[model samples]
Every structure is written in structure tokens, then in C-alpha cells.
Target chain A: MKLFSLEYGLFLLSVFYIFYLLPHRHQWKLLLAASLGFYMITVPLYVVVPFTICMVSYVAGLLIENTGRNEWKKAIFIMSLMVNIGILIFFKYVDFLTKSFFMALGALQSHFFQGSAFIAAPSPFNILVPLGISYITFQGIGYTIEIYRGNHRAEKNMGLFFTYLMFFPKIYSGPIERAHHFLPQLHERKTLDYELVSDGLKLIVWGLFKKLIIAERLSKVIDIVFQNPDHYAGIPLIFASVIFLVQLYADFSGYTDIAIGSANVLGFKLTANFNFPLIARSTTELWRRWHISLSTWFFEYVYNPIAIAKREWNQWAVIYASLVTFLILGLWHGASWKFVVFGLLQGVVLSAEFLTKKFRKIISSKLPEVVNNCIGVMFTVLFFSFSLLFFKAGNFSDAAMMARHYFIFTGDESRIYSLFQAFKLSGVLKLTFLAGLLLAVEYLDRNFDLKKVISRQAVVLRWLIYYMVIFAILTFGKFQQEQFIYFKF
Target chain B: MTDADVLKQVNEIFIDVLDNESIVLKRETVAKDVEEWDSLTHIQLIVTVEKHFKIKFTAAEILKFRDVGHFCDEIIRKLGAS
Candidate 1:
């Protein structure tokens, strides 16, 4: 059952009713069952792995907590970490490893056969990736680590831990809640509040509008340009790159909104994920604002540990740590060379910024503030767009071709006009309308909730705005259910 | 040194590392309290503290200090040992 679908809407309604109707003692069971039911709808058998892992970890945590010996507690925690990471590695990286191994063998064989006049082709492996595995595994690992650190107590109840791991709203894409934030909230009694319901519904509607009208429609043009980069050049590629930035923002933040909104309806608060990333004045600021949950995850778990471990090695170690963290982040997206390069480019750029911080400060002081801000935003956007070539292209060669075409501008203007002509007038209108809507909403809600503002406005004005938004979505929204962009990760 | 004196020195380190003139240190204040108290600046603070106080913290001890109060306590413990 999809989170946005009518069936799932009904399911959530029933679950919410049952949850609030039930006593505090039994409320958790309903949520656990509902979460499992939601997961079962998508991946029935694969659900067992995460469910079992959650149970085992829960037991292990309690055991560690009860143990008197520090050494035994440490051992138990290490075992839990190893098991969780072992499961994640096996399920996520098996196909990548297999293909890599075959490729390496083929390379050696080809070199040998060049002298012997023989040929052999390595067959690729087909792997069925489990749904929501990345999110659940990460949450599990974070929980284990938090317990180990004595930052949080381990949950003795297996069911509660399971619910924590497989919370339906955040299962697909996440705000990646930390244990300390989410667990206690789950244990608390929630009352049915009318304001919460209304606010949640409004946020969900806004998220749907973002996904359907803005992201999906823009994606059509982005896919067209990226699919055949050789056909178009210069301005068209630039337009595509700009559209991609919008699409990524809409898709990711939209999903996060829905996740947070749904959690709010249940009286659970997930972490805020996006923070006006496009408005960022620097690549460093962009990272700080963009996919904040994941960025912070890398910061706390990956970057800090590595950087701290090698602190005596000085600034070079800091730079190296940042690069390694970003590279791992890119690899986390997919098992592709393109993602690796894309990540490395971001690392290199950000590291350059860190190295030149003093020089940048001197230059900024010399220039006008407005001019400096413009240059900073331009540099970040251009760098981001250039790296996105690796994300959009199928392989390294395709990425190179797109980059070359983007810069060289060798293709004819007639070709660009032809490509533009291929898109429907309605698609163009929809894109323009959605872009305007997104920008207006983002501008208004730059610092606070736009919905709250609307709610407090004159009733007639608020109703008119609401109806117009709903009408636009119904009339112009792309209805095809494209999987959220981050689901693959 | 007195706790207040230690804190005054710590406050100077925070001001120097964070590049902020008006940094007010509190018992409950952690790294996230200041805008510029990020991981890189954090190491610089630690290094500066080590040089100023002639004390070193183990990784485990560093990780355990949740706030300024805990950090102060650790610093005091190190100085007392010396």
C-alpha cells in the first residue's frame, strides 16, 4: 500500500482510530502490527530479515544492560554491530561484489588471451534489492551504537524496538530519526487532537503537490535531455541541469514532508530533513542545508570518528577524512562508478573551499557584499550542476559526453528548438506553474511554516488559496506514481 | 586553578576557536550551542586547551564529556593528577 494512495489513506485512518481508541498499554501493539502490515504489503518475505534483526538486537541490548562486567557488555555490543553490518553488506553489496570480481577476472583473462587469441565474456549477476533495507539497517546500527555509547538505554521490549525500526512513514525514505528522539515518543500516550489532524493533512497535500506537479513534471524534461545529451547542447543542457536541481529538491523535500507529516499525525516527530539547500551561498552551506539527516549522519558517525582518530596528522587528515566520507556517501547511493566520481568531485570541491577559507575571507572583504554573495551562489550552483552530470548519465563515457556537449556548445540551435517542440504546451505550462508555486511557497516559508500562516489568515482568503492549490493539483499534476528519488539508497 | 578561573580560560579558548567575541559558556552548553562550534573547530579547541592547561584527554574520556560542565570536571581531574 502506497502512503499517498486512497487505500493507504483509509488504512491510516483505521489505524489512527484504533490507536487512539485503545488504552495506552495496548497502543504499541496496534502500531507494530500496522507497521508490519505496511511492510508486508511491499515485501513480505524480506520483512523477516529486518524483523528478526530487530528482535535479536533488542535482546542483545537488554543483555548488555543487565551484564555487570564492562568487557562482556562491550563484547555483546560488538556482536550486535557485526551482525547488523553483516546482514546489510550481504544483501546490499553481494551483486556489486560479484560483478566486480567477474570484471577483474575478465580483465586478467583478456590480457592473457590477447597473446593466445581467445575471447571470454563475463556474465553479470541479477540481484533483487530488498525494499527499505538501507533505512532500517542504518536505524538499527544507530540504535546499537547509541546503546553502546551509553547515550541511551536499550529497549527491553522486542515489539517496541521492531516498531522503531520499521515505522511505516519513514520506511521508504527517511528523516533518519535518532533513537533518543523517536523511542520515548513511541512509549508515550497520544490523544486525538483536531489541530494536529488538520495540520498533518495540509502538509501531506502540500507534499503531494510538490511531488506530482513540480518534481514529476520537471523530471519529464530532465529525462528527455539526459537520455539523449548528444541531440542537444549548451542552453538546453543548462536548462536541464537547472530543472534537475529543482526536481531533486522537490522530490526529496516532498518525501520528507510527507514522512514528517505522517509522523506528526501519529503524534511522533521525525527530524527535519531539508533546510533550503538551493539558497545556500557556499558548497559547505549547501551540505549543511541539504538532506540534513544524512549529512549529519555522515558527520557524527563517519567524519568525526575518522577526523578525530587522525587529528594529530593535522589539516591534511581533516581534508582526507572529508573526502573519504563523501566518497562513501556517493557509494551509498548505488554500486556505480558514476556515483563514486560524483562523490569524489564534491569532496574535492568542498576540500578546496576548506583549504582556501582564509583566501576566500580576504576576497570577500575586498568585494561588495552583494557581489560576493552572487559569486558564492553561482560557484556552488555551477559546481552542483556539473557534478549532477555523473548522477544523470548511464556511465563514465556518457557523463564525459554530456559534460563536453555542455561546455563545447557544438550542437545546432535548430536541434534545441526541435527538442523544445517535442514537449507539449500543457507540459510547459505545468512546469512554469509548478516552478512558480514552489518558489513562492519556499520564499514565504523560508523561516517558518507557510501552512500555519495560511491557517491564521482570513477564513475566506485561506479557503480560496486552499481550493486553488487543490484545483491546480487535480488539473495539472502528473498522476504516474514514480518511486521517490532516495528510495534506491 | 579555581573552577571559575578554569572556565574563564575555557571561555577564551571557545572565543578564539569559534571566532566569536561574545561567547558565554554555561554548564549545560554543548558543541551545538554555538554557530561556529563544528567538528573542525572542536579539535582546534581541544588542542588549544591541551596546550594551555598541559593536560591530555583519552578518546573515551573526550567522548564521555557531554557538556561544558563535564569538560571542566575532566580538566580539573587532569590538573589535580599533575
Candidate 2:
């Protein structure tokens, strides 16, 4: 079920109450049952593959841990890595690979016959891609590697380890929990506190407001503009791109908030994935903040190993490593060539920054630091907006068309004027009116503990604010679109 | 050699590799404690240490060092083994 849907909301509410009623030691069992139930309900037979992966990795972790021979341990590690990564590739990339193979064959076949004589179209294979397969598989691989590295001990309990992999809150789109961080916490028998419940509820409310009001509404217009950018020009393209950047932020971060909030109520703490990424002053810094868990996964698993292997190459090593890491990061988002190009662009930009830090430092020293930061923020936002055009577009050609329209401004004066006329400051204001309210609360909540601040206010004032927000949500909310934006990934 | 001697040599290598001469590493110091020491510059630091100390670490050993003290411990162990 979509996390924001009414059905899932009822599920979470009932699950939360049922969880605390259980004896402390049995709490984990309740969670495991809930997790399995959630998976079964949402994905049906798709659950078997992940269950198999979890079992394989669990056995692999134990073997690596128990084996006294170092050679065997390393062999076991590589075998486990291959199996998990192999599963990921087979499931996630099969359709892409199949289509690509058919296209290539079609090209070769078309050469023998005249242009319209031959066509090869492969039927799209419908694979039941399990929920959070990438996330759980990565977690499993990391666990195996950690065991071999002597960093973490293998979990003796199969059930607990399985629960960690199948944990339902993060199953759709994860702040991919590392084994070392999440495993020990699972053992703690939690007694629910009133404060924890309140905080969790507040965060969930805020997350819902972000998704239902801002992101869904913005997506309607974004879908129209991106779907047919050739029909529009200049300002509309720019406007759509900018709005899209914010919409993605609102959607992804809102989902993350809800995930973290739900886990918190359940007395588990998933890592924070987004930390005000839009406010980041530099692209490098933005990457560090955005999808932090995934970024760390790449840095630790992909970049560091490659860098160390090429250590003698000096900074060239850094560039090579970063290029590979970001490309994989992009590919992880989807199986399209668009994602490949998007990643290549990021790797190029980031490598450029690394190579020219000395020159950039010299350039920056001439400006005031605050002014430099402002410029950096502006540049990053524009660059990010440009890159996401590929992510948002139907394909590479659409992205190119949008980019062309954005820069060429070749439409007739009447068309241009009408496009400009279509831009309504008031329309955006109306759509984002509740959005603005949410963001203002978020801003206040940033520097200080907003809940604590609200706690100290008169009870009537606090209730008034709460009631007003809830009222607005029920009255003005777009409950129609319930799927979180990241579920596809 | 004791960890103290390794620490002295490693401290100089950190200063050179990180390009920050003011760095004074304590036993508990990790990557986050230093501003210039990030994952990108990490291998540079490791390679510099191996060159200066004339020792090598395996790929697994390379990623397992937890802090400066843990790094020094590995260096000492390697020196003794050699």
C-alpha cells in the first residue's frame, strides 16, 4: 500500500497500538510479523526472492565469521557479494537489457530488408520486482562485508536479521539501514513514551502536509510541461524545471520524514536521509546531504575500494573513483540510458570541482564569503534543475527538446506573450499557500526544537495551530494522489 | 617500535598529504575530527603512510582501520611481522 494512503494509515495506527501491548522481548516478533504481513499484502509472491536473499546472506555472514582460514573467508565474501549483486542486476536490469538486445537485433535485421519491411518488437517482460529489493540487498551485502572486515559480528538469530532486511517502514524507499546501526537497536525492548508518540505524530503530520498539499499539486503541472515541452518555450520550460526541483525535494524528503517518524514511534531510529538539501551552498555539499544513506553506501562500498586500489595514481584516483561511484548512483535510480547520462554529468561536474579546487579557492577569496555562498547556492540549484530535466522527461529526446526550448526562445511574439500571460503568480501562490505555511513551520523548526517551542506556548495557542493545520489539510488537501514519488526506485 | 614512534611519522605524513600543517592527531582522532580528511583524500593519506613507513596493508586491512590509534596499531603490527 502507498504509505500516505488511508489504508496504510489505518494499518500503521493499529500496528503501533498492537506493538506496545506485546511483552517487551516479543516486540521484535510483532514487528517481524507486521513487516511480513505488510510485504505479503503489498507485494504477494514477490516476497519469496528477498526471503531467499536474506537466507543466503545470513548463511554467508555466519560462514565468513566462523571460518578460521582467511582465504576461505575472502572467498565466501566474494561469493556472497556476487550472489546479492547478481540478484539485484538480474531483477532490476533484465527488462532494460532485454529491450536493448531486441533493439540491436532489430537494427541488424533491418539492414537486410528495406526500411519498412522488417520490425522486431520484443514483448515487455513483466517481472514482479519486490519492494525495497535494492535497499535490502545492499544492506545484506554490507552486512556480509562488515563481518569479513571484523567490523561487526554476524547475527546469531535468523529471525532478527530477517526482520532487519524486511523492516516495513523503509521497505518502499529506504534510508538504507546499515546492519551495525540497526541490529543492536532491534534487541532493545521499548516501552512507549508519551513524548515519543507525540513527536512521531507531529513529524508524520508535517510529512503528510508536504506530500498531499505541495508535491502532488505541483506534479500535475510538471507532468503537463515535461510531457510536451516542444509545445512551450523559454519561461515555461525554466519555470517547470525550477518547480520540479522543489517538487522532488518535497516528495522525497516528505517520504523520508514519514518513514523516520513511523520508525520513531515504533521505538526504532532510522537514519535521517535528507537534511535541508535545498539550503546546501555547494553541489559537493548537496550530495553529502541528499540521500545521505545511499551516498554513504557508495562512498564506502564503491568509491573507497576503487580509490585504494588506485592509490598510487593520486588525484586521478579520486576522479576515477568518483566517476564510477556517481554513475552507479545514477544507474541505481533506474535502468535507463538517461540515468546513465545524468550520472555521467554529475561525475564530470564533481570531478571538475575536485580538479580545480585551487583555482576556485582563488576565485572565491576575492568575494565575500556570504556572497560566495549565495552564488554557489544559485549555481547548484540551476545545475540541479538542469540535470533533473532528464530524470523528469519521458526520454533523452524530450529532455533535449526542453533544453532547446529553454535556451533558444524561438517562438513567435504572440506565442511567447501568451506563454508569459499563462504564468500566474497568483496560481502558484494559491497552490503553495498551505505549502508556504508548512515551510515557515519547517524554518522555525530548523534552528530550534519546534515541538518544544510549541510546548511552552499557551495550550490554547498550540491547539489552535494544530487544529488550523489539520483543518486546512482536510479541507484543501489533494488526497487523490497517494503514492510517494520514490516508490518506483 | 612502539605506537608513539609510528604516530610521529604518521602525523608528518598526514600534514603533507592533507596540506594542513596545523594538524595534530590524537590517538582517538578519526576522519570526522579533521576538516581536510575526507573519503576522497583518505587513500592519499594511506599511501603516503605506507611509503613513509615502508610497509603494506592488504585490501581488507586498508578499510578496517578505525582511527589514528588503530592505524598506528596496524603499522606497529606490520613492522613487527616484517
* Candidate of highest lDDT: 2
RMSD of each: 2.7, 2.8
lDDT of 1 by residue, A184-242 (tens): 98888888877877877787788878887789888887788788867667766776777
DockQ for all candidate structures vs. native? 0.44, 0.64
Q: Point to the candidate with the largest DockQ.
A: 2
True contacts kept of each: 0.18, 0.68
Q: Each model's TM-score, in the order given?
A: 0.92, 0.92
Clashing residue pairs, backbone N/CA/C < 3 A, model 2 = none
Q: Candidate 2 at residue A4, lDDT?
A: 77
What TM-score results for chain B in every one of the models?
0.94, 0.95
The per-model lDDT (C-alpha) reads 0.80, 0.83
lDDT of 2 by residue, A373-461 (tens): 89988888788888888788888788877766777566662244534444466655654564466557667788797989987899999
CAPRI quality of model 1: acceptable
Off by over 4 Å in 1: A108-123, A410-433, B18-29
